[model samples]
Target: MKKIAVILSGSGVFDGAEIHESVLALHAVEKAGATWHCFAPNVEQLHVVNHLTGEATEESRNVLVEAARIARGIIEDVAKLNVDDFDALLVPGGFGAAKNLTDFAINGAECSINADVAAACRAFKDAKKPAGYLCIAPVIIPMVYPESVKGTIGNDDGTAAGFNGLGGQHVDCPVDDIVFDEENNVLSTPAYMLANSISGAASGIEKLVTKLVALA
Candidate 1:
């Protein structure tokens, strides 16, 4: 069986991982008959957010701890993810992805990915393994690829511009469509960036997972 590594940001849509996207990604993994191992960076979140109020809060949270909420307590520190244990990697979108996995939300194209996250993603890149990224998670595509890699984020101008700065070719995509960077073995979709419902997000996500597993 193919072992797919799932990297989650947090547990919520406001402060961490988008619940729908995260769950859907996992479903796609299972549907493909591939086992998935969850991983998260063991670090403090940039800050906490009250999802209901959409405001910053005073509580400090660990990225891995919060991510475990979504993984149902079965997850590992991304720093310890062994390349040999997984055939592919997948990242779901949420504010936490930009905030915790990489600082693209605050720093734009100049953002730096968390060291452990970078290492995990780079391991797949170095091994020529395929990866699937959804929503803002695709912002880190360039960081893992030396050449200009092609990806999409539902055509958000500012984000696309930032992707360009990071040495990536941003293609405008819709919620139901995906961008396949064949040479790099990378797949991405706009997902919630353009979806009005969970099913819409799943359309592209399912395709991405299918393609990624096939590549693996």
Candidate 2:
């Protein structure tokens, strides 16, 4: 069986991982007959936000703990992730991906990836394992892999420009489609980046999981 390592950012869409995207990815992976393990960095989130009001909150949370909510408390610290044991890696997008995994939300093209997160992704890259990045998670791809790659986060002009500036080629895609980087064995999809509904996001995510499994 192909084992995939899934990296989560946090718990919510505003402050952490997009709950829907995270869950959808998990569902697709399982339905494809592949097992997966979840992981997250054991570090403080950049900030907390109220999902209802979309305002900053006084609360603080750890990335791993919050991410655990999505994994149903079954996850590991990203720092200890052994890439050799997993056939592929997958990242679900939310603001948490930007603020926690990489500073792309705040720094855009100049964003810096969290050390542990980058290390985990790089380990898979070094082993030549294929990976899938969803939503904004693709922004950090250039940091983990040297080759200029193709990816997508919907068709937002400014965000796509950021990917280009960071040594990646951002392909414009709809929520139900995927951008495949053949040379790098990487797959990326828009997910909630353009989806107006959960089913819409599922289309691309499911395709990504199937393709990733094949690559693995």
Candidate 3:
């Protein structure tokens, strides 16, 4: 059986991982006949947000602890992720991917990735293992891959420019499609970046997961 490593930012769409995207990706992985293990950085979130009100709150939270909520408490620290044990990697997105995973939400193209997160991702790249990145999570792709590595995040102009500025070639993909960098063994989908509904997001996610497992 193929084993996949899934990295999460947190449990919510406002400040963490997109609940729908994360769950959909996980389900797709299993449906593809692959198993998944979740991981998160052991660090504090950039800030907390009240999803209902769409407002920032003064509450403090740990990335791993909050991400566990999505993983059902069956996750490990990203620092402990050994690429040799897994066939592929998958990172679902939300604001947390930009805010927490790489600070792309705040710093855009100038953002730096968390050391542990960078290490794990680079491990997969170095080993030539296939990896799938969803939604805003593609912001981390250029940092992990070589110059001009291809990816997508729907068709947001500002976000697309940032991706290009970061040395990645951003492809304008549709909600139900994906862009695969065959040479780099990387794949990306718009997911919630373009989808207005869960079913819309599922179409691309399912395809990406199935392709990721097949490549693995």
Q: Check candidate 1 and list the clashing pairs.
A: none
Where does the lowest 10-residue lDDT sum fall in candidate 3? 100-109
lDDT of 2 by residue, 10-79 (tens): 9999878899999999998899899999999999999999888999999889999999999999899999
What value does the lDDT take at residue 12 in candidate 2? 93
Q: TM-score: which candidate is best? A: 3
lDDT of each: 0.92, 0.91, 0.97
- Estimate the Cα RMSD of every predicted model relative to the unseen true structure: 0.8, 0.8, 0.5
Question: Best candidate, lDDT-wise?
Answer: 3
Model 3's C-alpha root-mean-square deviation from the true structure amounts to: 0.5
Residue clash pairs of candidate 3 = none
The runs of at least 3 residues in candidate 1 whose Cα sits more than 4 Å from the true structure, single-residue gaps closed, are: none
lDDT of 1 by residue, 32-73 (tens): 989898999999999999888889999999999999999999
- For every model shown, the clashing-pair count is 0, 0, 0
* TM-score (all chains, Cα) for each model: 0.98, 0.98, 0.99
Regarding lDDT, does 2 or 3 come out ahead? 3
What shift in Å separates residue 117 of candidate 1 from its native position after superposition? 0.6
lDDT of 3 by residue, 90-176 (tens): 999999999999999998899999999999999999999999999999999999999999999999999999999999999999999
